[model samples]
Target: MKLEKELIFPKGFTVRKVIELVTANERFASKIYFQTKSHQCNGKSMLGLMSFMLMTTIGESYIISVEGEDAEKVIQFWNKFVREIHENTTLSYWEEEGAQTVQEAMCQSISFWNSSVRSVAQSYLKPGKKEI
Candidate 1:
């Protein structure tokens, strides 16, 4: 599977936000990855994104490509993720650090992401199973 979209982060967005987005797609057990002219990172790993120096800024054109078994669902998640960021620029979902430690952040991240995309990924799920 494959798809490409030009996305813009509202403003003040960071690699951490990328981490969250990447984390969301990672849940699908798919072999997803992202790339640009200079960087390519595994969509399923936060470290993969950071280590590749994948970062976003307002108005920058990010040509993102996603592929894998659940690529379509992940792309939908990314679309929803970016739109929500624009709508809530003042309170970017990745914020609200209810997480105090690394482990806590990991747990909270999974929690935040699950809450964000359960609906979009649901179509790929078996009836009543709630996950993709």
Candidate 2:
């Protein structure tokens, strides 16, 4: 079974705070994952959570989905947690995609190619293959 919900946080709530709360409850945290359009992270990892750069701004939405036996309980916990922390926060659906400048594109391209996994798998991974 799985449980899922979408939510936003309060302006004062930081990702670090999220890390503390999520990790504090190991049993619940281990059963869930959080996702946004471009990023997904384990609820229990500070670094993984940081990599998403989650913000408490209006319109940005996050999806919390949990698996395993306690999925319902974990989902309920996160739902209540977000509501309590961000009572007055507005909720909206923000489109997370957009175009970028030529310079920005170049930088992103370089970053992807130079990223740890990409750098190592450059030769092994490619756009297409002729097939056998």
Highest TM-score model number: 2
The true-versus-predicted C-alpha distance at residue 110 of model 1, in Å, is 47
Lowest lDDT 10-residue stretch of candidate 2: 93-102
lDDT of 1 at 115: 50
* Residue-by-residue lDDT tens digits, candidate 2, 1-132: 877888763343565556666575476634677788777887766776666544323346888777778788787776666676566544332212211232244344554454665554444333352111
Q: Note the clash tally of each candidate.
A: 0, 0
Q: Candidate 2: which stretches are off by over 4 Å?
A: 53-57, 88-132
Q: Could you estimate the TM-score for every candidate?
A: 0.53, 0.55
lDDT of 1 by residue, 17-36 (tens): 87687667768755666666
Lowest summed lDDT window (length 10), candidate 1: 94-103
Error of 1 at 5 (Å): 2.3
TM-score of 2: 0.55
